[model samples]
Target: MPKQVVPEGARRRRRPTRQGTVLSEELIVRTALRLLREHGGAGLTARRLGLALGADASTLYRYFTGMDDLTRAIGDELMGRALDGWTATGEWRADLRALGLAVHSSYLAHPQAAVLTASRVTGRPREIAVDETILGILRGTGLPDGTAVLIYHAFIDQSLAFAALDAGALALTDEARTGDEGVWATTYARLPAASHPHIAATARLLTDRMPHSAYPAVLEMLLEHTAAQVAGLNRSQH
Candidate 1:
């Protein structure tokens, strides 16, 4: 006789581990995030996650189909964190600025996880909720549906793109990151004005600013343009 396969739900309902730890999807995701933070992306293996959770490696499958599934959950988890304790300020521009900053900061807080999952579309509840909130914010500005959607896409993508880029740099080893920064200070800052007048003139400012993420500045520019569009619409209506 062939052995029977257990249903996923049944497996999930199995008794707790000998350590008395009850494994849930939330527990697994949080543990995976912690592992990613401590060990980087390459360290987020099933064996490692299982060890961290104090359960057998195969037991994780009771909740998730595989690591890919877990990756989506982890990404959604970051979005959830961004929404936690967040409330809209009623001013569309201010609300959007806060939302973008919240998402960017959440990703940077988990650089390893961001590097792995930033570019993904999780389609999970938290991700969907964030999308809805952003679109609602844009629409509340009295913008047309199509215009609201176009700006929505650009805004969210810009936030994630910058987060991933900065997170990648943040994930680098301390020595490697410092060396990269040193090139700007030693080489760009020392460029001769005669040969490279433009760079030489701005060298000090470049060295000061280049090491930081430009997301905040760019976000403001985008919002400025958006505010202009909203003002234009209001002017025409009156």
Candidate 2:
């Protein structure tokens, strides 16, 4: 058989097509997460996301109202992950620790989103679930109703602020990152031996302590206060 002739014009006009999974809202959010992880929060935009997904930027609106809405959804997803399998066992300290660490670790996973979502209290279902869980644990601790709510707010706000600061510091530019952290190191190194004897003496213990190590101590202190309040109520009952 004779070979068929190929047209040079047709060959020149042909372009290869990309083959892969189609882009969807969940897939887009997941891709945004990767971008956030790699480039930080400012990097998350419809254009960038579309480029990542190989789709038109407008397609994202089909799933989300806007970037703000999309970010909220991402936050909700994070909260859900953090609350996975959480249960109250009527042990206040253990329950509080679990919730605090879960929220902290969740935001740590996506530092950029943590900054965006941390300040905004979305009364959305997952967030409400978290609130309910904490309230349930605090109530189960045998504290009065008002006392339980107060402790819940105090603990939650404390945890959220610390987590946000930790995430934000990590996301800073190299110059900013070095400067912010280096200040603490520099501050102590220059502390006078005579004028600031106390600061000079304990500077080693203060400087060498990691945020992780110190945070739990602070949390324990807060829990201690909560425990004291609960203990007072118990004593009064007796």
Query: Which candidate has the highest TM-score of all?
Result: 1
Clashing pairs in 2: none
Candidate 2 has its poorest 10 consecutive residues by lDDT at 10-19
Worst 10 residues of 1 by lDDT: 1-10
For candidate 1, lDDT tens digit of each residue in 1-238? 3234346467564577656788888988999999999999999999999888778888777777788888999999998899884789899999999999999999999999999999999999999999999999999999989989999999999999998999999999999999998888999999999999999999999999999899999999999989998999999999
* Model 2 RMSD in angstroms: 11.2
Clash counts per candidate, in order, are 0, 0
- Writing each residue's lDDT as its tens digit, candidate 2 over 131-196 gives 888898888878889988898898788777877888887778879977866655689756998999
Off by over 4 Å in 2: 1-25, 85-90, 173-179, 210-213
TM-score of 2: 0.82
Model 1 stretches astray by more than 4 angstroms? 1-12
Error of 2 at 52 (Å): 1.9
